[model samples]
Target: MSAGDLPDPAEMTDQLLDEDTVRQVLTEGTLEISGRLTDASNLTLLAVSSLDGVELECVYKPIRGERPLWDFPDGTLAHREVAARRIAEYAQWDCVPLTIMRGGPYGNGMVQRWIEQPDDSPDLVDLVPAKKIPRGWLPIMRAVDTGGADVAVVHADEDKLKLLAGFDVVVNNADRKGSHILTTAAGGVLGVDHGLCFHTDDKLRTVLWGWAGESLPDSVVEGLARLATGMAGDLRLEMDEYLTVTEIDTLARRIDYLQMSPLYPMPPRGRSAIPWPPL
Candidate 1:
């Protein structure tokens, strides 16, 4: 969808200053504004309370140069809008409606669906106990694995995983880190961060690796096959209007590989895995 299709920020004027709202600033020069919809970013998150009450989280170019790493230009809300729309369409998943909100006390920002944190939240990255090693990845895989018996060793909600995988494939997600997967109190898992996604490269960098060399579950394989066959048609059509032709082609290749090699090995460490916002 184009910028013209997005909701206008002027329409949300009064709600933006609600008293019940809370705002917290996050690292990497992001500000979390609660209560109303605001700007768009490479990554934007908002938590909608009731129907009208909304909380927003936005990641944008850092205003200050204290750390000396931030470099992207400010006021690029249009780029994020395109990425979010393409991802939501390709995966058929719901995304927080995004819009260009006023900048923070610092730089430009974006508003997105703000997800409420679960009451019983685990440390986002430290959930996998040290002893679990690669085994911890099993449960996450099972929750998302779609292949079959030889490949599917654990049990998890398959439908959710399929959607998540589809989102990854569609966005060309380069980073599926542990922290980015949020587990809600309602026992739902949500994926975030699409800024570094949709790149025209093999950019799948995830921490879940237990099923590295194992055959994929039948269901997972089937999902990949479906995506592969429909990619050039339905999926591409959905993304074409929002994404570049090259970006869509990369997504198609990833789906094809997933279908052709049910047990595709993970990319070797150091070869593809790099730190986010690489220094």
Candidate 2:
């Protein structure tokens, strides 16, 4: 959808703010720090933005709170998170929520629309008994559990997931654990915590490799084409604000390669293909 045609809040299932209103709240509203997500590697804050009686829930990851990574430049993760959302928007996939880089209570950071997942939302990626992989789930790997029982790493065989997998390939996402995939009450899929994405190298660690070696769906190819078209024009300029020139060039190259091959990439050789603590 175009910037003017933001998807309805109802489609987001739990969000009461429309896209424009949410963006307004994130950009110009009063931010109130409510809590912290302790499990987050960075100092992630749970916050609410209020504007003229409209309140929106959001996650704030301050740049100063970011933990330095040996690979990614310090303080750049927040920018990368915003860039990931831009890429998704360019691809017309809507796989990521509205994300922006702005000043928060702590400091400059990435602010994103908080997704409220319904309790009954289905699991997209999961660990199940090896012998009983769900009917429509594709197994990525098998391992012996701590109890010595065989278990499998699997994800649902759904188009939304396939689209996300394609998105990860383009971004070279270095972390795509099961927990990163959020299923909304509307049954829409949203991916979060993208600080590990958009690297220039082949650090594509993820658990959504269920479709490895499979042909890319026609819709996915169309999305890639859209991204490519953007890369050649405004998208490159936009991403330049966040990623290095080499990184943006590498992303363009990945899009081109995928279009030529039109298949899901195989797990890279000589590397751990999945993230630790897969969920």
Best by TM-score: 2
Give the candidate number with the greatest lDDT. Answer: 2
- Candidate 2 accuracy as TM-score: 0.94
Weakest ten-residue segment in model 2 by summed lDDT: 1-10
**What's the count of clashing pairs in each model shown?**
18, 0
TM-score of 1: 0.53
What would the per-residue lDDT of candidate 2 be over residues 110-183, giving only the tens digit for each residue?
Answer: 99989988888888898999999989899988999999999999999999888899888889899999999998
Residue 89's lDDT in candidate 2: 87
Candidate 1 residues lying further than 4 Å off, grouped into runs, are 1-111, 122-170, 269-279
TM-score of each: 0.53, 0.94
